[model samples]
Target: MAEWINVKDIADGAKFYAGAAIRIMPTPCGLEEGNFIPENGLVYLISDNASDKSYFNCVCLSAGEEGNVICRLERKGNYVLGSEIKRMFESELQEAFISKSIEIAVI
Candidate 1:
């Protein structure tokens, strides 16, 4: 049998790193440069699931922050939703990362 692992440990593995925290500065949905709501924001991380190797999408989800905008990409069934994946890219629009997941392997 496979080694049993705690969900917290598994979730902790998926970290969504952002440039800055939402609490540091409060900005509107547009021209904010990050995808996460302050206080109750979504975790955001940049993955290589973009068309090009330089661009990435910001995933959202309903999870608390372990720190900053990084959280575990909650896996459900056999698929994971963008919202559950705590990771966002540097953008001014919050909807830019909507319905998209980084196709790059999590290093």
Candidate 2:
């Protein structure tokens, strides 16, 4: 498996290669490898070292009275709206839907 490193952990002036990918997650929560993109996170294909990488998307959940549900949404290109993840989290009651424990390291 390709190593998945947290962007926050990357040192300044770190190097990258063409065709490499960056996982654009709405939140800082980690994602497991081999899962669908947007289902957990969005993947940005690096066009080159010159490709700009920045995203400010967010997830809006329905009110608690609505059972913390996510409103239906349309897919945006290759990315799944964060609403779907919120729905998965709510449906699973957050039990291992994301992760049950915090990870101090990335692989």
Task: Provide the overall lDDT of each model, using Cα atoms, as 2-decimal numbers.
Answer: 0.33, 0.32
What are the clashing pairs of model 2? none
lDDT of candidate 2 over 1-107, digit per residue (tens): 33555544444334443233344444323324333224344433323112223222222221222222122223344333334333333321112122211222334
Alpha-carbon RMSD to native, per candidate? 14.3, 15.2
Error of 1 at 98 (Å): 19
Clashing pairs in 1: 33-91, 37-41, 44-87, 44-88, 45-87, 45-88, 49-103, 58-88, 60-83, 61-83
RMSD of 1: 14.3
lDDT of 1 by residue, 1-107 (tens): 11222222235233333321121112375435453456333534433333433333333333454323232333343334334433422334432222222332345
The deviation in Å at residue 25 for candidate 1 is 8.3
Q: Compute the lDDT for candidate 2.
A: 0.32
Model 2 regions more than 4 Å off: 28-39, 48-107
TM-score of 2: 0.33
Error of 1 at 78 (Å): 27
Q: Estimated TM-score per prediction?
A: 0.24, 0.33
lDDT score, candidate 2, position 10: 46
